[model samples]
Target: MAHHTLRLRVRRITPEAEGILSYELVASDGGRLPPFEAGSHLDVHVPGGFLRQYSLCNDPEDTRHRYVIAVQRDDHGRGGSRAMHELVREGDVLTTSYPRCDFPLLYARSYVLVAGGIGITPLLSMAYVLRRQRVPWHLHYCTRSPERTAFRSRLVSSFAGRVTFHHDQGDPSQGLDVKALLATRTGGTRLYCCGPAGLMRSVREAAILHQWPREKVHFEAFSAEATGAITDRADTEFQVVVRSTGATFPVPPGRTVLNVLRANGMRVPSDCEAGSCGTCLTRVLEGEPDHRDSFLPEPQRTTCRNMLVCVSRARSRKLVLDL
Candidate 1:
């Protein structure tokens, strides 16, 4: 799929919480922007040539006028957040891909939203839509402290009775009881979770133990590290053959299929090279994949029809890809 880019001007930059900043983007020409849905994210081409994905937090209904995104500065990260915080300024022009959604909200009787830290970005948009539609839903936002919670005042004022704040104060044990909260499955209720890997994993396990339908649970990870793709496992050299071009490349240890393909002069549409985004998903014509991506559902991993080349590898000696 081809992604279109839009040049936008930074209209405002607000400090939402400690280490977090919310940026409001508008069309550079002072016109309406493209429409987007809840859970959609923008692929920001940050200064210094780094591409980072940020979820849209503002109401989707207002997307025609502007788009809002929150960025959490990670001093230890690969510098995307740092660039946005230290280099980006209000009124500067920025380039971003059209909004894309991987964690879209589905129709259900009610909803349970789980957010951890900056993961509240996408869920906040969902809250707006649910509220407008008069659906029954609740947001459980978990943060280290009240000072670190983004959109705190807005959430309290707008979602008053439907939002619960969980502050663990850096202690995991004092956090929300994910297991207990999901102990019972309600008919026609769906769960949407976006957060650190621990929280999402816990929600997945709890939903499974309580017999929640797999289709009823959804998740989106904030970073590649949260997906466990960057691991300590030793990698081995392998070969990949492109079915369309009949081109073969050797994927050596410590390098990803994406890197190899791009180095070989192949253009692949990708957003999050960490495998959290499904932008680089490629069909697998042959071979089993060492699936490391959190983007693929559990059932899809078993079928092995597709793979995220960014972080996944071949369990077989060779892979035939429908590139």
Candidate 2:
């Protein structure tokens, strides 16, 4: 389906920075928001910066007047989070894409959800769905410190027993026991995790080492950027042949293939340009896809088939693009 932009009024901007600040807004169209699943995320467009995805924290079944998003100001951010934390206000209007998500919740007799920092946004919805359905689930929210965490009060008040809050900044010993948790989980259980790439990687490795089914463990990252090392080593002089357009361009040593294509007037849909979302995914007809994006399954990378143009590149000469 063609993507349609929505003019959503900033109905609410709640911040959980050592406390809570309720900033409510209304729908510009005064209509019901699009129906989305438990893990769906909304793409908030902050111009001159990036289009970052935020999970719909409010109940999807709630035909409320408008939508809700909770954001915490991050200091070392590249604009989106800071913009959302500082610039966004109640009643302000902004255009955003409908909810899109990679971490889909599945049927599991029991669930183990792990969230790190702002990664709690999506997990919030998952917990909400599970609670409403009376499904058994628990959350392990890991934050740098309690001072920077969002939605602290509500998460505790509502899910006192079902949730476990961990402040990694204060003490590492209080960290969530992923190894033990995964080991004790029943067979029909599924695990969902969202947070830092390091945590996700560690969880995946531990689960694999424990022989957990890869398909049963689902995760998504809030932000991921290409390391300067990878972005610097490659020469940007390779030829990218658009099989359909028969056009070529010089991708600068530090520029992404997606940027070059967009500069040349190609209409490519992208969100969280950090290669987190599969939004910029393109089928690879030939050549090896550098495959930097975490969106691709580990096994599929061998095929070197699909590529996320937003932040990935080619390891060989003569890259053929299906665009």
The best candidate in terms of TM-score:
1
Candidate 1: misplaced stretches above 4 Å?
Answer: 225-323
Pairs with backbone N, CA or C atoms under 3 Å apart (clashes), candidate 1: none
The clash count of every prediction, one per candidate, is 0, 3
Writing each residue's lDDT as its tens digit, candidate 2 over 1-323 gives: 11577788876665566533433435597987777777776666654445555666666676356566665555554455556666777778877776665567888888989887767878888888899888788898888777777788889888889988777775645676667767766778888887766566667767877888866878765642211112223233466789897897766444468778987999888754555557789987777766666667778778657888876767777688898
Each prediction's TM-score against the native? 0.76, 0.71
After best superposition, candidate 2 residue 148: deviation in angstroms? 2.4
The candidate scoring highest on lDDT is: 1
The Cα RMSD in angstroms, rounded to one decimal, for candidate 2 relative to the true structure is 8.0
Per-residue CA lDDT of model 1 for 1-323, tens digit only, reads: 11468999999999999999999999999999989999998878788766667899999999889999999988766567788999999999998888988778999999999999999999999999999989889999999999999999999999989999999999978999999999976799999998886677678778878988877888876744235444333456789999988999999644579878998999988754546657799999988888878778788888859999987888789999998
Error of 1 at 263 (Å): 22
